[model samples]
Target: MNGIIIGQFIPGDGFFYKVDPRSKIAGIFFLMIAVFLLKDIYQVLGALLLTFGLLIIGKISFIKVLKGLKPIFILLIFTFVFQILINRQGNILVDTNLNISLINIGLVIILFVIWRFLAKFKKFNFLLFLGFLFGSIFIFIYSSFSFDYNLTSFNLQIYEKGIEMSIFVVIRLLIIITLSTILTLTTKPTDLTQGLESLLSPLKKIGFNSEDFALIISISLRYIPTIFDEANKIMQAQASRGADFSEGKLKEKLKQVISLLIPMFIIAFMRSEELADAMESRNFVPGKARTRIHELNYSYRDVLVTAFTVVFFAVALLFRLNVLGY
Candidate 1:
């Protein structure tokens, strides 16, 4: 749970840390749009390289970036597998018959046991799951000694197009996640809130409560880490009470989940109420104008970032339009 970094801000002395939050927001917005606009593999690779360059410029270590990607490791693997399975548009790479048998089932159970045992090692967590995934696949695919008890069998065909598409999608996803993580890693919550309010100030002319909106966004972002920490604590407490969340039937797992959720929701509500009371005690009015302790100022670096992002986005748009012959 702690591997997630979307809403968690990391303190750093990087280049992005000094840039205005508004500029960072705008830059990330454009970069994300550009990422979506990419059509070909080369464009995707280029974007990936650009994102990594930004990460290095921001002085964000690769370890932290990998940690950010850890939470979505399963999702990425699923996406890769799904894409590979669904797309059969090219030359066949792997053609084999997969069987579900006692051998396969036993191997899978053993693999699960191994995974559960090795999951305690934080550094090899992703590698462990990855190895487990491919090991399971190989076991099912090549285990010829089925003891004449095969439950089902199917032919598995993986094509070049599938592999290409899977890599493309996974890389694209990584790029998107890394870019967003970079923003949140470098910016502070209060600065983000004020920057958003400043950018949304013009909306007040249209009867929109910009401060409320900014505060809502800020609170939501700030609550992410808090909620994850709370969930972890609750899980640990439940585990100490002999609650087994991992090894259980579906029904039992659901019950265990309920046990976790009830307290979580109660705690969330209590925190929200406390926040409300604290705000009220501070005379925090919904629509009142407020002075900032730190004002956001755009430097020349912000201007360069904005301009570079604009160019990058324009080029990506051109690629999408097929104007670059891509």
Candidate 2:
């Protein structure tokens, strides 16, 4: 949960902070669409560069933005591997016969078991661990050990197009995550609510309650950090009571997780009740018109930024469709 950074705001007076929240929100939405429209590696790289540029302009640390990727690291790697294995469009870069035997399988299992034990004694380095594991697997497959009987024989082919597609997928995902991080880091929850409400105000003509919608959005964003904090506290209390969440068998870990989740749910319900009572006491009502302490006002910078985003969207669409012979 700590690895998840969505809806959490970091206070700063950078370029993004000064920009109108509506413009920032719209620009981010457009940029994400543009990123998805891109197919070529060069277009993806350009989008990534632009994302990093926004991060720098917002005074956000690249390390902090990278931290946002932690929760999705495994997913990204899985996507990469899946793409590599399934894609067969281009020429094969790697074609080799993998010798699968009982002896080899047992040795690989033993190696993994040993690695797992070693991981417990110190902090785990994911990159080094994955490198070692894959290196071992690669060496095992490409070794000269041959069995008398061919249990199973299949050629593993890696295509050039697969590599390119995987790279594009990973880079596009990173760009989206980075841009979202920049948005949350620079914009406050209140500002986000205001921007959302302002943007959705046109829907009021169709009987939509924008204020109520905004209130729900604001509360959801505001409670994300609080819920994570409470979860940490609950986990710590469980740990103090001899609960081993980390080094447990699958069944035991599931039981331990249940223990944590039940308490979290109870706490969440209690908090909701308390909030309702507090709001009721203050005569709060849904869909009520309220004046903001800091009203959102668009400046010249906001207009210029919005126009630039429009041009970017147009260019991306044109390139994607090959309208300009890209």
Instruction: Report the number of the highest-TM-score candidate.
Output: 2
Clashing pairs in 1: none
lDDT of 1 at 29: 86
Model 1: residue 145 alpha-carbon error in angstroms: 3.3
lDDT values of the candidates? Answer: 0.88, 0.84
Model 1 reaches what TM-score against the true structure? 0.78
Please list the residue runs of candidate 2 whose C-alpha ends up more than 4 Å from where it truly belongs after superposition. 1-6, 117-124, 146-151, 220-283
Clashes of each: 0, 0
Q: Which stretches of candidate 1 lie over 4 Å from their true place?
A: 1-6, 118-123, 215-290
Error of 2 at 293 (Å): 1.6
Taking all chains together, each candidate's TM-score versus the true structure is 0.78, 0.80
Give the alpha carbon lDDT tens digit for every residue of 1-326 in model 2: 55565666877788888889999999989989988998788889988888788777778889888788989998999899898889999788998888766666666777777777777655566755785679666755765464534356577888999999999899999999998888888888889888988898999999998888888888887788899999899999999999998988999999999999999999999999999999989989777767767799889879977987998899899998899563
